[model samples]
Structure formats: structure tokens, C-alpha cells
Target: MSDSVTSVEAPEIVVPEGVRLEPERLLDLYWYMLLNRRLEERLVNLYRQGKVIGGVYRSLGQEAESVGTAYALEARDYVSPLIRNLGSILVKGAEPVDILKQYMAKGTGPSRGKDLNIHFGDLSKGFIGPVSMLGDMIPVMAGVALGNRMQGKDSVCLVYIGDGGFSTGASHEGWNFICAQRLPVILVAEDNCYAYSTPTDRQMGNRNMVDRAVGYGCAGVQVDGNDVLRCWHAASEAVSRARSGGGPTLIEVKTYRRKGHAEHDDQRYVPPGELDTWEAKDPVARYERWLLSEEIVDRSQLDQIENRVRAKLDAAVDEAEKAPMPEARTALDGVWSTPRWTAEHPNFHDFAAEIGS
Candidate 1:
């Protein structure tokens, strides 16, 4: 979009030390990243058609970080993603049709039309829904890790926060508590160049976010967020350390937010050449190039993956479009204590039957 765009050289893919991913796992990462991109594209179309109930927040150029990091976690680990980390949700086993239905506010969606966008999560799938209050999820995820420790489980929690969100008092407080208790949690701070219209320089005095990790008494590392392999490597090491009783690790993923804050925003605040610069480092395309160059996947294989992603998204969109909206009477169903709640949590509401009698 800039008049004087500079040609940026793509970085070489160097696999990190002490981390290894099989060819099958590499292809899986590509699948999830492609799925994330295609799904968001479909949502954008639905939004333009006036079908989406809320704004579309895309992770367009940052797919690698989301997919790669979440892929590193085991099934027992918990991930609390932010709005732009939809790729992580897909990696954590969320269905594309369910995400489409949620955006369309269909009754069949995860939240049963009570919420919109990536606002619903399945705890059984090891992911917590994004909190609108930004850094509030830090403390919440710390609690999750604490609960796992209390239950004598080896599970850890990975919580994502933007560079701007990391400056919040809540984030500082939560990190302090996590450090104090030596909780098993991984904090991913996405340095996506800008926060809304404000640049990172204006948001905080310390440009390097990972440096704050030392003040909090934890391990920290910064990685190129556009590199899928690097993201996976960094996250894997952190997960391993946390699972082995090591305290928290702060991972600062250097990336860029190519899209606007939401579909409605024009992103006029961005510098003239900034978008063009980041476009050259597009995560999905870069990863595909690396996969091909390294002989990990053939051109036909990449094409097939793209085709599969498109077909799956097409089906999800069609199914979600035909789904019904929530009925008015069901609005108050989960608003208060009910038989359904008691039935779902018998131990927590043991007096429900007595009250009914």
C-alpha cells in the first residue's frame, strides 16, 4: 500500500538446538496455519455479507507464532489465547465449523449464540477463551497452573499478551504472583509493532519486553515470530522447562499486526511503508518456502494442503450459514442457578435436589 516499498530479504530457517520436529509434524504445522488463514478469510467474507455478529480480528501475518507455539504444548497443557491467536485455538483442537458458527452467532455454536467471535472456549480441549480485559487472563491462567500443581498433575498453562497489554498493572501483578509461587506458566508477549493506533515506543519505556522477565525472576527469550520453526522451538523448550518444575518463562515474539485492530478500523495510523515491510515476512508464505526448500514438502503437497483447507472452510461456512439463531426464551437459561447447572455439577450443587423436594 506504500508508494516507496522496500524489498526485504527473507531470513534463513535455522532449526533451534535441542528441538526436533518430524516431517509429519512440520506438515501438521502447515495444515493448522493454512486452516487458520482460510478460516479467517471466510469470516471476513461473512462479515462483508453482513452475516458476522461481531468484528473480525485477523491474525493474518502472525499465523506462525500462534500455530507453532500452541503445537508445542501437550494435550494436558492449557492455553489462554488473545483475540488474534485463533491459530492457537485451531491447533488446540477447535473445529472450524464451530468457530464459523460462533462468529455467525448460531445456536449450534460453542456459546449457543450467547457470545461472538473467538469468545468461547472448551476447557476440555485445553484452551481458555480470550478475556476482553486483556491482561486479566494472566492471573486466571496462573490459577489454572496452580490448580494443576495442587492436583499433583504435570500440566502447565500458556497465556498470551500483547506488548501493550503487558504494561498493564494486572499483568505485572499476575507475573509477580506467578514468580513468587514458582507457578508453571509460560507468558507469550507478542510484540506486534503497534497496539491499536499507538506504537510500541509510545506504550512503554523499555523496548525489549523479554527484559522484564529478569525483574520478575524468570527465564526469558525473544524469537522471530514470523518463523514457524523458531516459534515452535522456543515454545517447546519453555513447555519442557515448566513441566519439569521450572518456574515461568517469558517469550517475546517479535511480529507485526498487518491488519487493522478490527475489520472496521482502516489502520491509517500505520506508517506508509510498515505494512509493505511486514508483508514480505508473511508467516504462512515464508514457512511454505522453507518447507519446500528443505524438501520437507513438495509443491503438490503444499497445493493439496491449501485445497483441503479451502474445502473445509467452504463446508464450515455453508453449515454455519444454515444454522438457526438462539431462541428468545433460552436467553436466561444460564444466567442463574438452574437444574441444568445442578445436573452438570452434582457435587457443587448437592442441595439442589433437597430444595426441589
Candidate 2:
């Protein structure tokens, strides 16, 4: 059988229960999903052309999970995005040009080329930079949530972790701390069925990861990660509950990464017919069909949105390419090692001065 997934007749568009969104709002959701798809596709081209630094991690088949959960956040809320979560960051107000520039390691990028691709964050936009260590950000997000609660703000923090990362020690420790404190946070495990090249079965014995939440003393719900509306509904409920002092919620988003872990991996480990199955249920295509059948958006409108997204992506790439590389001396510009060392042991620096004398 060919590896390509045939686009068979799509399933019916089921409006998520209790969620009432206008047509315009529905179109907005579709726009973000399309934008994410186009942006990642462009990144792949850039990676192949050797324009991007390090490896290009993509959220290709996981757009619905990212966008839907991000859209549920309020402006005051915060999020800790994972490696494959460009859509979530974009929905939180990150400029695509900045994202491209960051990947290209341009002088004007968020980290001024002092960092790896897509590993910087803007706190102004409520996004925390992704750490290469999987599952480490869970505690960071818990701290952010604690800060908000301490300040008397009803804001919640959302953190994304992959199925592979969810098994890490940091994931369990972070959740343990947050649950004990009754912190306002939502944790979404994007179970894409693979931990790098390893399958979930090899990584964890349990079939459904959500069931683990029972031990953590929090509500856990699973969602169809490919269906944007369904994810949005689940996220909306979790966010509402957290903001209202309902403690934490663990949400498992069932999705897949059609591409390799990064551009470097060939994804040969993926079983035959698995990729085809997911490609047929692509979130962007699925949502597009729903919009058309429901008359929420016509073919012309959808095409127009796609054209705009392509143009925007092209412009972002062009601008990032034109941007200059960072100056070498700027590496020392943001270092704060001395201040932290001095604060930790005030007498240690003075002792060093005495020793020099």
C-alpha cells in the first residue's frame, strides 16, 4: 500500500457540546490552524535550504491541540509551550517574522542569535521559552501560576508536555507540587503516540495517560486533539475551572506528529499505514470541511484566508532572510552569572578579593 493517506469522505462536523461560537469566531480558529500549517511547511523548506540553525521542530499534525488550548487563555494568563507548539505561541501574539528570525538566528531575533531555533519566549505575551530538557517547564509554569494566585489575580497557567515528556520525573514532581499547593494551572499532555522514535507502548504500560491524574488529585479529561473545536471546548472548561479556584486539571490531547521528531530524523520507525491514517484526519483539512459543510465559511473565503496566510509567511521569510546575523561580542551582553553568584554568597566574592590581595 502507498504511504499516502487517501482523502476519503470526511466525518460529520460535530459541534462540541455546550460551546456556542459564532461563524466569525469559528473562521478565526480555522485561520490560526491554516497559518500554523503554512508556517511549519515554510520552516521545513528553510531547514532543507540550510537557513535555519539547529534542527527545525514542527507542530505540523498537532495544530488543533496548540491553537485550541491557546485560544482558551485570557491575556493575563501565562503558558509554557513545548518544542512542537509554534501554533500555541503564535496564537499568544508572537510575530511570525520574529519566529522566523529566531530560527534563522538573526541579529533582530528574540535572543539576538544567542540561542537555538524557536527556543526563546516573550513574557509580555505570556509565553515562556522552551527548554531542551523535556518536562522541566512544568514547575516553571507552576511558579507562574503561584505568582498570579499570590498577587490575587485569577489567572491560570497552561503548560504543554509531550507523551514522552509526561513520563519524566520533572512532570510528576511539578504536578505533585502544584496539586499540593492547589495552584491554578492546566497541564495538557500531547500524546502523539511517539516519544521521539519510541512508541508509547514501549514508554508506558498504561494505555490512557489521563488515568494517571486520579493519583494526582485533580480532574483529568481527554480530547480529540485533531478536532479543533473539541480541543477548544475541553481547554475552555479547564481554564474556567482553574481561574475560579478549582485547582488544577490534566488534559490529554490525543494527536500525532506526522513528521519526524525533528528535520534530522527520517521517521522510518513509524509503522506503515500509521502516517496515512493521521494524514487523512489532518486538523486543518478536517476543520476546513466542517466550515464548508456548516456554511460557516464558503470555499472562496477559505481560499482567501489561505492566500493571506501564504503571503504573510512569504513576507516573514523574506524579512528574516534580509535581517543581519548577530554580532559576536553580544554573547556577553546578557550574562548575569556574577550577580547571581554574588547574591548567593556575599562573602565569597569578598574572600576572593582578600585572596587576590
Candidate 3:
């Protein structure tokens, strides 16, 4: 994983029809995927070197789950990324330099160094920063969708959660609320087969997460999480239906976590041969091979694109490294806001004065 991105193309790979993207768009997708992989690898190195300010999480084998669903979204659509959805964040208008800065806790990061390690979001880009709790973002996402509905906008919100989060009280509460309201939301279960070290078998009695959707009366579809095009198609349909008058959709993407839960996790609980099996299905490599064999891109062109991405990421790291730290006094900023009740209740001012004392 420390080595640079590989351009090795798998033999005998064929993409199913209708989901094939144009050559230029396919190249862009590859660029974004490569960027994410490289950036995460760099983060791991930084973590090992004790430079990263906090725990580092990598998308690793699940790039397609994020990139594909994000690719299906429009500029006006909303996304809430979990810890492992770096590809989705990058695709949703977050600059690599900004992300690196965030991890490095630089003053110039999205949170202005108020937080560390992927805890920031830019709502202007239609991305909601994730909450620390595993499944809390689901309800927040539903609220965003409800707001879109109230405004009569066609925007739909896509939120990602892990398999472990599937059983969480917040997950159930959020999904139930979204379903009951018929909100414009797409719930993506990135079933990586494990919640931390615990396998899905130990976590839930129902292995089929999409079937849980039937209870909510929303459309549910499962896909080959490693197949970027398939994931994209499923997400596209869900997004389209949600944007229209139709309702929410629950998409289950079956994938595996090739690494531990985070940089700190050693993953001793994983059984032998499991990693190898999922590694063979590496989505980025599969997409690269399909693009090469189908003549969508030649070897040299793909190499050039990768080289460009490598250079860009290197420059981003350098820029982030040079950024200054945030001033201590700045911590007081952005943590508080005026509450509606302050203006609504005349006696609230007296209560505020009493607390101030």
C-alpha cells in the first residue's frame, strides 16, 4: 500500500452495456479514483510517521461505492459522507489540498483547524460534514431532504453508512423518519462485511440489508459494489426517482474492507484469504482494465492521466504542509449561534444574563 498507484490491467475484463461512460468522462472518473487512492495512501504514511493529527480512515477497496454514487449526483444534489467515503468528498467539490490540510490540522483547512481528520463539510458544495456518531448523519440527511422537499427543489440527498451502522438506533430512526415522510433521500449501505472487526454475521441476524427497505416501502436494490458502472446505474435510478415525486431508495453495495477500520487498527480478526479475494475485485483496477481493453483509453493515455494525478497530489501535500496552524483564540468562532428562542421569548434575555453571571 505504500507503493505508488498501479496501472496493471486485468485480463478478460468486459463491462456490461448501457453503463459505459464516454471516454473523456471515464478518464475523469479514473482521475478522481486515483486521486483518492493516492491521497489515502499518503495519509496512512503520515499516520505511521506520527504526523497526522488524528485517526486516519481509508476507503481502500470501496472506492467504487462512493465514486459511483457521487458520480450519479447533480451539482444541486446533497451528499453526507461517512468516514470511508473520501472519494465521494473529492468528487463533491472538495479540493485535495483542502482535505490534506484538514487532516494535517492546518489553519487553512475547511474547519479552520477547529477540528481534525475528515470532520469538516462545505454545505456550499452541497456536502454535509459527518457527525462523529456512526449513524447520526442519516437523520441529518433526511432533514436536508425534507428541506429540499419543502422548497420544492428537485435536489435529492445521498447518505452513506456502514453495515454496522445499519443496526444502530440512529440508523433505524432516521430511515423510518425518511420513509414516513417520503423524503427525497437515497440511503446507501456500503456493506463492507464488517463493522470494525466484527463481521456482519455477528452484528445482525438479517444479512440482506436491502430487504430491510421493503419494510419501509421504498425501492431497494443491491449491486456488485466492485462494479463501478453497476453502482452508478443503481444510484442514478435512485437519485432520479427521489428527485422526482417517487420516494426514497435503499441501495446495498456488497464490498469488503481491504484494510483495518483505520490506520490504528491492525485487523488481526480478519480470516486468512479473505483479503486476497476482495483485493482481486479492486474496483479501480477493474475500471482501468475495462477502459483499456474497450479502447476507451490506451495504456499511454491512462499512464499520463495517472502521472498527472500523482503530480497534483504531490503538490497538494506540499502546499498543505506549508500551511500555518490556527490561532488559539480562533477556537471561540463558529461554535455558537443565536437561537430562535432568544428572540421569541422576552424573558430569555434575563435567563441568558443569569447564566452569564
The C-alpha stretches of model 1 lying farther than 4 A from their native spots are: 1-10, 336-357
Top of the candidates by TM-score: 1
Q: In candidate 3, where is summed lDDT lowest over 10 consecutive residues? A: 1-10
lDDT tens digits by residue: candidate 3, 58-149: 88988888888898999999999998899898889899899889998888898998887778888889888999898999999988888877
Off by over 4 Å in 2: 1-12, 338-357
lDDT of 1 by residue, 179-258 (tens): 88989999999999889989999999998788888788988888888888888988898898898888888888888999
Error of 2 at 246 (Å): 0.9
Q: How far is candidate 3 from the true structure (C-alpha RMSD, Å)?
A: 7.0
Model 2, total clashes: 0
Clashing pairs in 3: none
TM-score of decoy 3: 0.89
TM-score versus the correct structure, for each prediction: 0.92, 0.91, 0.89
For each candidate, what is the lDDT? 0.87, 0.84, 0.83
lDDT of 2 by residue, 43-119 (tens): 88998999999888878779999999998998888888888888888888989999889888998899998886668
Clashes of each: 0, 0, 0
Candidate 1 at residue 105, lDDT? Answer: 91
